[model samples]
Target: MIKNLLFDFGDVFINLDKKAPEQALAKMGIRTIDEEMTTWHNTYEKGLITSDQLIENYLKKFPQLTALSFQQAWNSIILDFPQERLDWIIELAKSKKYRLLLLSNTNDLHIEQVIKNMGAVRYSQFQNCFERFYLSQQINLRKPDLEIYDFVLRKDDLLANETLFIDDTILNTAAASSMGIHTWHLEPGFEDVTQLFEVKKALF
Candidate 1:
């Protein structure tokens, strides 16, 4: 009865090292990421602040760090997009069994790195599989916020009961589930999106 499928881009499709950014920044003398830093990150994710502004803010704090170095640290979290997951989504799109959508809490820099890592051609192919692609930076909305979920459901005219949201983060999944949307909080190493059918068989 699941008529629509909403997927989180990071771990569900592409692999991400969530700690890489923090580790990368630590090397640049940002040993402790304070509340202000986290707030800036959230603001940046919501598109309230531009990447240049973020860089400038960080530069004001750490004048010694170069823009290129800061950019690399900021983008270190993005990793590979597995071909099998891409193939699975493409095949699923061909079936037309459900309305496919991609909802990612991502910023411009990360997205740039993602495209660079996947290659433009392959990234385009992956994007072609989705009916709509919502990136947090572009939409100015982020996950774990009810508004983002509501926006997608309302805009798509999708029934929460008939939609399945797949994400790697429990907080995100829990938020969606509270709104009556089914979710698969896929664990990174143990769960592969290519095995969606076998894994979330109850939803199908």
Candidate 2:
């Protein structure tokens, strides 16, 4: 039986315009996100680089872009956290039906934006619903990496078979599944987390 619920923050709980950042950057003359840019982003997500270092790297690459502008463009991907989804998770937590955990591949800047968008009270409520909240930058690990999944399972002493991992990204769910963890690759518009029990009824 599924005894633990592992959820991804973005797209699963909160909505994200995945292409917003790229479009925002394009307006600032950063028409292309090159290999180096992607590497910096990945490194930032893993906490290998500080937020200041990330901003500096971008500023160095595009001399015309200011730190404020770059940060604005980078944070454009974050969107609203719907009230109904928050209500559902809060209710689920109250039931204590499963061990709740949140694992997200997120960086400092994005988190700041999330707080700004979600508001402090709502964010705190959402956070309190989880037993353990793991952010990629804070944990020094990221999704799609086997080590990260192993770390979570080992740290929590959770059985892969009993933990149901929910994420909007196929790549992340696929990685977790490879390690024998149950997963739901929830499609954004077609699937809502509130219907977890109905969608994965057999597991429940």
Candidate 3:
């Protein structure tokens, strides 16, 4: 039986534009994100660069875009966070059926936009649902890395066999699965996270 539920916040609960970077760059008149820019992005996620620095750096690299234009492009990655998901998770948490946790590979810039788009009250409600919520930026670690899984497991004294991690990314799922934790890769056409627990029982 699954005693704990670990969820990825992006597509599992909220929707995101998968081509956001491409689209954002197009809007900013940048043709593409080059190899060096990719490293800068990773550095930003790892807390090596501040959001302001990232904004300036990106804009400077292009030099053809306005700061506001880049800012808009940056925030375009953020998408709708539906209330239905929140309500569902809230009810699920209240049942005490499992220890709920949130583990997401997200950075400060995206979070800032989520806060702005979701508002403080709604965002707080979402954060409060978790027994523990871990963000990659704050932890200085991202997914597809084994240490993060170990971080949560050790922190909560979780048994891998009894922990279920649901994420939209295949790499993230693979990492957790390698550690013996049950995982579900959320796919829009084939699976729905809202019905996960029930589906697991049905599989039995």
Models 1 onward score TM values of 0.98, 0.99, 0.93
Candidate 1 per-residue C-alpha lDDT over 1-204 given as tens digits, one digit per residue, 9 for 90 to 100: 889999999988999999998898888778999999989999999999999999999999999788999999988888999888888999999999889999999998999999999999999999999999999998899999999999999999999999999999999999999999999999999988888889889878
lDDT of 2 by residue, 52-155 (tens): 99999999999988999988988999999999999999999999989999999999999999999999999999999999999999999999999999999999
- What's the true lDDT of residue 71 in model 1? 95
Instruction: Score each candidate by Cα lDDT.
Output: 0.93, 0.96, 0.85
Sort the candidates on lDDT, descending order: 2, 1, 3
Worst 10 residues of 1 by lDDT: 21-30
Q: List the residue pairs that clash in candidate 2.
A: none
Tens digit of lDDT per residue, candidate 3, span 31-150? 777898888877777677788888888777788877787777777878878888889998988888789999987888789988998889989998998999998888887888899999
The predicted structure with the larger lDDT, 1 or 3, is: 1
> Where in model 2 is the C-alpha error above 4 Å?
none
Off by over 4 Å in 1: none
Clashes, model 3? 0
